[model samples]
Every structure is written in structure tokens, then in C-alpha cells.
Target: MLLLLLFLSLPPLSAAQLCHPNDLAALLAFKNSFSNPNSSLPSWDPQFHCCNWYGVECNDTTNRVLGLDIASVDLHGTIPPSLSKLHHLQRLRLHKLPNLVGPIPPELGQLPLLGYLVISWTNISGPIPSFLTNLRSLSYLILSFNRLSGPIPPSLPSLPYLYAIDLSRNLLTGPIPESFGHFLLSTALDLSHNMLSGDIPASLGNVNFSRIKLSRNKLSGDASVLFGKDKVADTIDISRNSFEFDFSKVGFMESLDVLDISHNKIYGSIPKQITEAVYLQFLNVSYNRMCGEIPTGWKLKYRSESWDNSSFFHNRCLCGVPLDPCK
Candidate 1:
């Protein structure tokens, strides 16, 4: 009768009890807040288990929710704070929810296990929550293409494992934190297409980013740190800024493939150092105050069409293989 008693005491494993009661309640609360016209959560019914729901994943042993990815689902309405109840949640992606408005709920900081948080292409606005710094396990964070404004929280760089941050195409203003160099293993850092102004932090050169896009901002000053020695950045786009560095600084980027520093106040001759970039594919230094001969790099040699000519045009006095002779 001991085995019979144990079996009788076990919870039912039917569809009626598909998920942990607390997780189910949280999911229901989350679903109730959104206007899901497409019926993305048709299976999100109390009669069935939440583990079987459209965008939910649960751990097999403990039955705790582990991942929730409802990206690009046309989810409208603010994120429900009840989601913090899922203590086991490790990866949460709610990207491209253009209709989801309002500030990111501070309740997200309560998720102790969250490692990857991607909420890009949303209409969420307000200052990035400082509580995010408390989430030490966070590694990949992409909050790009949103209406989020205010200076990026400096506490973010202090996150021990954070390796990627993309806040581009937003209304974010103010200087980028010099502490950004603390992301020792970061591969990509993009803060482009914002209203951010001030000198590009020289400390950014300390980290070895593979791609750095600070284009179309109001940034100015000596950007030499970005391309100077120890820079392992391969693709860099700082175009349409007020940076006044000489073109010669680009020589250090031997691994560069795409370089667009156009429409800046940069001047001086197109130095031979740039030719050292054997991997250069796309080069646009146009619309600047640069003068003298275009380097005889293999990529710039046999180019045709006005677009090619346009790349070297609008400068003070550029001539050679690409453009017509200096007059």
C-alpha cells in the first residue's frame, strides 16, 4: 500500500494540468494584456498546459518555464509585469513588436536567470532601466530601433558578461560612456543613428570590436582612437558626424572591409596608409575637405560609373585613377 499511496499522491499529468500553476497564471496574465488579433495564443487556454503554448518552453524536470520568444507576433500592449514570476526564464525575446508601447517594465530585473534579452524594433520609450545592471548573467542585449531616449545607463558596461549592445536608430542623446571599454570580449557595438553628441570616447579603442557603427550622429573631435593601433575593428561607419580626423589614420585598419567616414570635416591628403588595407571593399571618403591623389589601391583602380566617381568627388582637390586629374 506504500507504492499505491505514493502514486495516488502524485499530481495529475493530464492536459488540464499542463504547466505549473504559477507559470500558467503568469502566461494568462501576459496574454490578457495583449491584443492578439491573429490568435497567436489559440492554444494558450487554461484548460491546456502552458508548456504546450505557442511561444513557451518549460523545463522537463521541474516544469518551470525556461524560454519565451514571441517576437514579431504583432503583440500590442505593454509587457505584463507578472512575467517576472517565471524565475526560471533564461531567454526572452519580444522583438519587432512595433505596437507594444510604453517603457520597459522594471519587473524584468526580477528575472534572475535571464541571459539573452532582445526587445528591438519596438516603440518602447523611456530611459533604459538602471536595474538592468543587476542582471549579471546577461550576455547579449539588443535594444535597437526603438524610441528609447536619454543617455545610455553607464551601469550597463559593468555587467560582467555583456558582450553586445545595439541601441542604434533611436532618439538617445548624450555622450557614450567611456566605461564602454570594459566590455572586453564584445564583438559588435552600434550606437548609430541617434541624436547623441560629443567626442567619441577614446576609451572605446580599448576593446576589440569587430564592427562599430557610430554613424549619423552629432559626434565630433579626434576619432583617431577608433582606427589607431590596437584597433581590431573590421567594419567601421562613422559617416555624417563632425569628426575631424585626418584620412591617414585609416592605415591601421589592415583588416577593414567596409569603411565609410564620408561627409565629415576630415581633411589632408588621402594617405598611402589606407592602401595597406588589403581587404577594403567599400570605401567612401567623399564630401570632405580631403585633397591630393587617391591611392592606387587595387579596389580603386578600374572603377566605372558616376557612383564610383561620386565617391571621390565633392572633396577639395582629389585626383588620380578613380577621379579625373587634379586641375
Candidate 2:
């Protein structure tokens, strides 16, 4: 009788109660928000348990919603604010829906555990929401290949755990925030192919970034601060900008591998210090105002076969090993 009494006190384990009622309603509401979800999410039917819905993951012990990953779906409509109902949502991705539009909902700031938030390859527009700073657990922020415009939120770096950020290939305009120099934990940053202008915060010179790409923008001023013998940055691509710096003064970190600073107003002989970058596999200094003989690193000749004729061309004054002999 004691065992039967214990069994009778346990919650029902019916298929309909597989997930928290709040999570189930939130999922159904999210499906309803989309105008054409049936073709992509047929498994999200009300007759079945919400945990069995495609792209939804639930915790085994609590049966609470944990992840909602929906990509390449024919979803058409704004992201429903009702998604905030998933109090335990940790990963939220809505990628490759070219038709999904509108600004990121403010309600998302309510998700305290959200770590990976990606809504790329869509028509999502408007400024990046500053409220995103509230996600104390966020680590990855990928909003690339969209129509997002306006200034990047400076508060992004304040997120203590943010590890990577990619806001490339957008229509953003304005100068990168000076507060960006305060980041101490972020390792990778890509703000390329936007309309950002003005000086790169010299404060960034102190932060040790592993990879930083600021190519194809209107950014000007000396970018030499990003280079230093003490820094360990492995990749630095700031090509095709109006940057005017004396390349000779720049220092190459031993960890340098990819360096592209072409198509700028940079004037000076190619720095011999670059030869010290033993791990460098990609180098492009072409289409600048640089002059004098290119440094044939005793190490460069080993990789000379990979250096194309155009790699050192258009500088008009660069000469030697790969080109006609210096005059």
C-alpha cells in the first residue's frame, strides 16, 4: 500500500504533459506567428508532445525548453515576442530565412540564460538592440548577412562572457565606438564590409585580439597601433580602406599568419620586421603607395611559389626578386 500510495502521488507522465505547459504554449504561439510554418514544421502539431517538435530540445530532468534551432525554414513574419515565455531557453537560432524581417524583439532581453543568439541571412533590420547587454550568459552573437543599419551597440563588449562577434556584410554606418577598447575577454571580431568611418580607437591597441577584420570600410587614420611585437593576433585584414600609415613602423607579432593591408594610403617601404612572422601564410600589401625593394625574407623564398605576381604589384615602386630588378 505504501508503494502504491507513492506511485499515485507522482505527476502523470502522459505524452501531452511531456513539456512544461508554458513552453508548449510558447512553441505553438511561435508557430502561429509564422504565416507558413506547416510546410517546414509539420511535426509541431498540437496533437503531439511539444518536446517532439522539430528543432526543439528539452531538458531530460525538468522537461523545460532548452534550444530552438530553425534554419532554412519558409518562415515569414516577425519574431514573436511570445518566445520570451520559454523561461529556460538557452540557444535561439533562426537562420537562412531570407523573408524574416523586422528589428530584434526587446523581449529577448528577458532570457537570462541565452548564450548563442544567431539570426543571420535574413532581412532583420534596424540598429542592434542595446538591451542585448542584459543577456549575462551570451557568448556568440552572429547577425551577419542582413540589412541591419545604424551604429553598433558599444555595450556589446560589456557582456562578461561574449567570446565572438560577427556583424559583417551589413549596411551599418558611423564610427566604431570608443568603448570597444575596454573588451578584455573577446577573442574574435569582424566588423568588415560596413560603412564605418573615423579613427580606430587607439584604446583597441591595448586589447589582445586573436583575429580582427575591419576590411572594406571607410576607416582612416593610422592602423599601426593594432600591430605590436607583444601582441599575438594571428590574423589582421584591414584592406581596401583610406587608412594612411607608415608601414615601416609597424611590428609583426610572432603569431601573425594572415595580413592584408592593401588598397590604402599607406606609404613607406615594406617593413623588414614582417619577415619575422614565421607563421604568415597570406600577405597582401599591393595597391598602396609603398615603395622600395620588397623584403625577400630568407623565409619568404620557401613560400615564394604561393606569392602571385599581383601580390606586390600596383605599388609602382616595389621591386626585386618577384619583379624587375630595382632601378
Candidate 3:
């Protein structure tokens, strides 16, 4: 009788929670923010469990919204600031939504756990908000192929964990902030196809990038800082700019596979050290002011696959087998 009484005194176990009601309400508001989301979100039935809804993921134990991935859908809406309600949201991706317009909502700063945030290939406009620095956990921030304008925030260096940043194909102007050089080591930096003008910051030489592209901008000055025998950059493209640097003195890293300094005001002969870069695959030195016989080496010695006359054309005077013999 004592054993049975002890068992009867035990408290009843409660079932684990469902998606937080507030989180569910936030998602519903996000759906309503769109003018035409019914067809795209057919599975977002109010009666069903939000964890089972399309493009929404919830934690297995707490049943709280954890991730939201909605790509290539025909939803026409600004990112609803209400999304901040998902206190545990970690990944938020909204890609290839061509009709989606407006600026990134500032309320995203409240999501302290947000790490991966992508809003690419859409029509989001306006300056990238400074509030994004509040995302202390941000790892990858890609906002390419949009119409964002204005100078890049100088405070971006404050994000302690931000690694890869892609703000390419936007309308951004002004010199790249010197703080950009403080980005974590080997960060992939792409600020291409923008109207950014002024000197390429000298500070950039301090960082070792995995790949760096500043092409099709109005940038100028000594790009030589990016090159050194000790540097480990894998690829560098500063093409279609007014950059004037002495290519003859610049050294290449063995890791270099692609280098495009074409259509610039750069002078000096192609350095002989380029021969040491066996990983070279794509090269375009055309339309520059460089002169002298082209350097000969593993990849440069061959006149096929972009080592030919066309690659060395339109220069003041370049000789050797690719052109006519130096006389």
C-alpha cells in the first residue's frame, strides 16, 4: 500500500509546446504583408501546426521558429519587421524574389541569434541600414543585384563574426571605407559593378582575402598594395577602373588563379614572377598601358587559353612570340 501511495503522489507530465503563439502570429502577419501570397503559401493553414508549414522550421524540442527560407516564389511584400518575434531565428533567406521591393526592415536588429541573412537578386533599395551592425552574430551577409545606394557603413567592422560580405551590383557610391580592411582574415569581399569612386584604401593590403573583386567601378590609385609575394589572395579583379599601378613590381601569390587588371591606366611590364603562379587560369591584361615583352612561364609561356596576342592587344607596345619578336 505504501508503494502504490508513493506512485499516486507523482505529478502528471505535460506535453511539449507547439510553435509559440506569438511566433505563429508573426508569421501570419508576414504572410499578410504580401499582396499575393495565398498561392505561394498554400501550406500555411492556420489550423495546422506551424512547424509543419512550408518554408518554416521549428526547434524539435521547444517547437519555436528557428529558420525561414523562402526563395523564388511570387510573393510581393516587403520583409515584415514583425519577423523579429522569432527570438530564436537563426537563418533568414529570401532569394530571387524579383517583385519583392522596399528596404530591409530595421527591426531585424532585434534578432540577436541571426547568423545567415541573405536578400539577393531582388529589388530592395535604399542605403544598407547601419542597424545591421547590431547583428553581433552575423556570419554571411549577401545583398547583391539590388539597387542599394549611398556609402557603405564604416561601422561594419564592429560585427565581430561577419566573415563574407557581398554588396555587388548595387548603386553604391563613395570610397570603400577604410574599415573594410579590418574584416576578418581571408574574407571574400566583392563590391563589384557599383559606381564607387576614389582611392582604393591602402588599408586593404593588410588583409589576406580568399577572393577580392572591385571591377567596373571608378576606383583609382596604387592597387599594388593588393599584390605581394607573401600575400595569399586566390583571385583579384580590378578591371574597368582607372587604377594606375606598376604591374612590373607587383608579385603574385602561388594561390592566384585569376587576375584581371584590364581596361585600366596601369603601366609597367608584366612582372616575371607571374611565371611562378602555376595556378593561373584566366588572365586579361588587354587595353592597358603596359609595354615590354610578355613574361614567359608555365602558363604565360603558352599562347593558348588567353595567353595569346588578343590578351596582350591594345597596349602601347608589347612584343615576343605572342606578338612580333622584340626588335
Candidate 4:
């Protein structure tokens, strides 16, 4: 009996806690599909329990695969469809694997418990599958910096729990969807650096996103609606687009930290009320069709960051402390 107690106390059986064999096979199959040029996947050998493998996590009670994060590991190859066999997976992040190219397998949408799915900065291309709208448990979805093309999937907003989405720096085209306003839980939505066009959806004004970035696209239309009475987003960057809206209608925002709307067709006098935004730290309205004297309060009182003469340059007409005094 003393020998039995000593054996039990030595160190609770480590590898003897067997994981579900099917889950082990699924993970082994996932590792087998990738060509590991940097030897980043050495620990994924099938000889060991999959739960002990690098970048794989399993439930303590059920021993089912629950998470897989193979980010920035120089992994190459398409995401294996076998990963869908991880029926209990809740989080999967495959970020910054630049050499990993190919379409995301639609089979991945089958992971019923997936709550966080991020596949950023890779070479993945193709339209985002519309079936991802059924991921009821998803709250954070990031597919940024890929080669993905096609309109933002119209069915994407159907994920009721989704709160943040980043599809930035892709090859996507087409207008922002009208249903975007329905993402009531979203606080951050970035669709920047794509070839998107068409009018900004007026409905976007209804959503209370705290950060919205629609910059470096070909979007056109009056943007006054985005800056209208709802006034929630604190960081709004719509610069480098073809949007047209007078500065007068760009209402005051008390919470604004950064505002960039440069290189557009916006024309009109800079609104003096813009100075009322004490929280404003960064403002870029240059390279537009704007004209008239710069607001004195903005020129003298604002100094959150260093400004170059170019910040006010290239306007249709302007004069003030920053621009040789409107003569």
C-alpha cells in the first residue's frame, strides 16, 4: 500500500492521460498537410498525444481539441480541411504566415463552437464564404491583409455575437453593404486599403462603432451622414477617397481623437465648431477643394502633434497663421 501511495504521488500520469484518438488523428492530419520550411511544426509528431503538441489546445475534461494558434510560424500550405474535424474548436488564429497561400477551405465554417477566427497577413485569396454567417458563437473575426477579393459578404452581419471585424488591406471591391449598420455589437470595423467604391451607406450612421476606417478606397458620396447626430465613433479615417461633403455639415464630435478626410472632394470653409472638440489630437483635411481662412482656434490652440505646412497645403484657397494669412 505504501508503494502504491508513492507511485500515485510521484507525478500524476503525464502522457498517460490519453486524448480522444479521433482528435489526435485530426491534429496529426492538420500538421501533415503543411510544408514546414522553417521546422516550425516539429513538435506535432503523432507519436505523442496531440494535446501536448505545440499550438494545439485540448479540453481538460473531454480532451477534445479546443484551440489552434499557429501564427507567424513561417508555416506554408493551405489550411487543411481536416481542421474542421476539430468539432470542439473555439479559437483558431493563423496570422502573419505570409507564405501560406490558397483559399480558406469552406469546410472550416463547420466548426460549430468557433468563437474567435483570425487569419490575417497571409496570401489567401478568393471570396469570403457567405456560410461563415452561421458562426453564431463568433465574436472576433479578422481576415485582414490577404488577397481576398469580392464584395464584403452580405450575409456576414448575420453573426449575432460578432463585435469586431477587420478585412483591411485586401483586394476587395464593391460598395460597403447596407446591413453593416445591423452589427449592433461591433465596436471596430476596418475595411481600408481596398478598391471599394460607391456611396457610403447612410445606415452606417445608426451603428455605434467606436472605430471605423474606410480609407484609401474609391468610395464616393456625401459623408455628412457618417458625422451626423449619432456621433459615436471616436476614430474615423475616410481619407484618400472621392467622398464629397462640406466641412460645415461635418458636425462637432466631442470624443474624436483622430480625423483624417484628406485627398477628397470636400469643399467649404473649415467649421469653427471643430475647435470645440477638445479631445481632437490629430486632424488632416488637406489636399481637398476647401477654401477660406483657417480657424484661429485650430491654428494656435492645437498642438497635440507636430504639423507640417503641407497639412494645410493644396487646398483650393486658404490663408491663416499656417498658410500665410488669407489675403
The best candidate in terms of TM-score = 2
Model 1: colliding residue pairs: 18-49
How many residue pairs in model 2 have overlapping backbones? 0
TM-score for all predictions? 0.89, 0.93, 0.91, 0.89
lDDT of 3: 0.87
Among residues 3 or more apart in sequence or in different chains, the pairs in candidate 4 whose N, CA or C atoms overlap within 3 Å are 319-326, 320-326
Kindly indicate the candidate among 1 and 3 with the higher lDDT: 3
Q: List, residue by residue over 107-185, the lDDT tens digit for candidate 1.
A: 9999989999888888999988889887888988888899999998988888888878888988999998888866757
Predicted candidate 4 versus true structure: per-residue lDDT over 1-327, tens digit per residue: 999988888865445247787787788788778887338788776557778888888888888889999877877788899988888999999988998889989898898899999999899999888988767899999999999999899877878888889999999999999999778584688999999999999878778787889999999998776674347677889999999878866786677778888899999988887777767777788899998887766533356764556777888896785688666
Residue 316 lDDT (model 3): 86
TM-score of 3: 0.91
TM-score rank, highest first?
A: 2, 3, 4, 1
lDDT of 3 by residue, 118-181 (tens): 8999998999999999999998899999889999999887788887889999999999999987
Per-residue lDDT tens digits for candidate 2, residues 51-123, read 7888999998888999999898888888899989999999999899998999999999999999999989999
Error of 1 at 288 (Å): 1.2
The count of backbone overlaps in candidate 4 is 2
Model 1 alpha-carbon miss at residue 109, Å? 1.1
Better of 1 and 2 by lDDT: 2
